[model samples]
Target: MTSSSTQHRPPIGIITTLRSSLPFLFFLLLLLYLISTSKLLIYPPHITTKITCQDSNLTTTNNHPKTGYDTELKHIAFCIAASSKLWKSRKEYIKLWWRPGETRGAVWLDNQVKIKKNETLPDIHISQDTSRFPYTNRQGHRSAIRISRIVSEALRLESDDVRWFVMGDDDTVFVVENVVRVLNKYNHNQFYYIGSSSESHFQNIFFSYSMAYGGGGFAISYPLVKELAKMQDRCIKRYPGLYGSDDRMQACMAELNVPLTKEPGFHQNDVYGNLLGLLSGHPVTPLVSLHHFDVIDPIFPGMKRVESIKHLLESTKYDSGSLIQQSICYDMKREWSVLVSWGFAIQIMRGILSPRELEIPSRTFINWYKVLDFTAYAFNTRPVTGHPCQKPFVFYINSTRYDELRGQIIGIYTVHRERHPRCRWKMESPEKIHTVVVLKQEDPDRWLRAPRKDCCRVLPSRKEGIMYLWVGHCGENEVIEV
Candidate 1:
């Protein structure tokens, strides 16, 4: 009976049977392909690769060994990018901040750098070859590819107990204590990119508004760098035409979907000429890293670039938290607007000015683009004008010391050059005042709380041709009024 039925059914046609099973076959093949592809792609540094579960014991900001403690010198690993040819001159800048054995990080050079005798610089390490990474930027050097890899390369070294990895150029002078203070705000256990953009408006427009200028330096949290190291090369390859390591690093950050957590304290200093205006009116934040020391004029008017930075560092030593911090007070009797940039300069505006006007930086320096127009600046700038009401007589810091017995920092700023300013108002000229003295108490944890400008009180001058001010937190009822 089965033979007869089979004969009547006329042996199922092979073509018809194949059609019914094609859908299942296609589904099976697609699933297999995806599994194989994922297996191969998982090991390579893809932008989206998640390595969290791969290393369960990996330390995070919250789980870091010293998580509860504030960030310190040892917790940060700095990767300084330098060319072997330029290392000789740049080492001086490094020597300014790199505390041997205490500061963690390395100076990455292109070739073997001959360490000078008694050179107390960070350990010099040659960068891994980056010729394999393609770069077609007409205006930028190919070495940017190598420099961009510094963060990943640094991570590969597996520095111990590192909560964050900080990157900077060899010429970048870091206010390390201040940097630690600023970084202490964010959680290093999470993916955080801490830095600021360039001072040049054109520069930001040309590269990115969010890209952290590598010269000024940027900090990457341990968790982010661990992830970044996994896929940075491939991420770099995806953008060969990018200008510098900064934009390349930024490109990777873009893929990670982590936006720049801008800390204004990280100054790119993308300007040339006198840094007086810039430093004197620095945003009411801690001064972190100062970049482009090689390009701009010496920070201190009369000193060499190195000497100027060291000079500024002198004030940093006494009260790093208050270094270049703008504290405004009025010389009511003299009818003068006083701006005390503690440890930097004390600008005595000839006429009483609103604190708002003092807050805007003087455009004493030129933009990086060399554009003469005011629009080139990333920030608002008050022209260094002849108007007595707006003109500032900046007295650069001549000497600063910690008065241990007084529990305060005594800073004396002397006129670099006495100026004869025009003011028909018959107001007593600040030019008559030869020196400005500021006493700032050491507030070791000033940055731990929300950042706000410190208040300054104009105390009576003990001697003629002198002015004294006590700089500290604003009183509940106190206000900087003209």
Candidate 2:
């Protein structure tokens, strides 16, 4: 009976075995697919959500276009020097007097004037008495507060109707258009104060949200001013001194949980060098204001204003044949010559090197190309190759003493494409092959040749190698040996 049983049963049929294993095979495939698709399994981390105010009570209608001047809610007031002496001594005198003849005529003045069609110019009272006060130390703060009060009085019909009060300095070159545009974009009604905030600690006492425009250009909504005026007793009790008036105001608003929207490019510190560029020539057209601190002397204001106006007119005019044209032509020719010279130099270097010596080491080649790519990316322009007269390529030899060949293999080569055709490639093929030269590590002046046929090699496992080969762009036909 044992002998009969011992006769081995025929091996399980292949079809039967496959049928029995099918479910397991399917389960394994399904699991692999899930694993491949599950990014959470590979990388699990928490994401933080950013929060901000979403209350609608803070909305403002100050920025909207006026269908009728009466419909507008905000009014701007300038704290001009009241007395003739104050006006004569003010830094804004220059701007107000600049091109006096041009603006003196009623017709020209009307065209140049920016008053809205139906909107009357809010009465701008000159406060001679206030200007004479010895509040020069807190002059800016005093001026802002006075302007705020004046604005509050100007739109008195509706105590709750007013939404924003913009107070600016006399010398400041204000841009009403940009002020309106920005206020509209940000919806100024949502915040109580909007200005340029600075984080500098010394000035932090001025305001945690120190308006970068200093105390010169800022917008205070009616609600905030009302709240401050109502809580004047508490605010004064909390912050008793005038030393940090701006700071006190900001602190009070913060206590009320009022947010301040910081608007950049709206205010210019009168002395900033890029003032012309920042203001885009028409400071009054797009910017909120220029502090004019640099023009503290009354005469300089007029001079600066004249210069600004002249520059603006020139910028607007078309030059048919002027120095500008000649300069442009000369620049173009010089640049072209430089580029041609560079190309010739690169060609000469390429001709001097043997094919094997021209091949750069992998790391060195990658680094060099990376430099070129970085420059191109930064400038948003093409790489410039070297010219014949200019040495774009530089060599750096290893000087460290730790290794025997420490001073042996290091060198730097720069390829300025603008001057050298050999160094340049088609704009579309920014990553293509280009000429490279090597020099003695110790004596960079001495040129050396590379020994490889190609500067870089395709790694066997790299997808780039396979794809490039498939596209027939790879030089080597054989598969890379791992």
Measured over all alpha carbons after superposition, the RMSD of each candidate to the real structure, in angstroms, is 30.0, 25.5
Per-residue C-alpha lDDT of model 2 across residues 178-273, encoded as one tens digit per residue: 444445444434555777643122233334544434334666665666666666445545543344344555656678777667765344342222
The TM-score of predicted model 1 comes to 0.83
Residue-level lDDT of model 1, residues 1-482, one tens digit each, is: 46676467544587688889999999999999888665331121121221111224333334444323477878999999999998778888999998987888888888997776787988778889988888898988999998999888888775699999999998888999887888887888889998998898998988889888898899999999989988898999999899899999999999999999999999888899888888888887888999888888887776898998888889777788888888888877877788778888888776667888888888899988787899998889988876655567778888887755546667778887845556677777776777776766677656654577888877654466777667776656666655
Taken over the whole model, the C-alpha lDDT of each candidate is: 0.81, 0.32
The list of candidate 2 runs beyond 4 A from truth reads: 1-85, 89-161, 198-207, 210-215, 268-286, 293-303, 306-482
Judged by whole-model lDDT over C-alpha atoms, candidate 2 comes out at: 0.32
TM-score of each: 0.83, 0.37
Error of 1 at 169 (Å): 0.2
Worst 10 residues of 2 by lDDT: 320-329
Deviation in angstroms for 452 in model 2?
Answer: 47
Q: After TM-score superposition, what is the CA distance of residue 53 in candidate 2 from its true location, in Å? A: 38
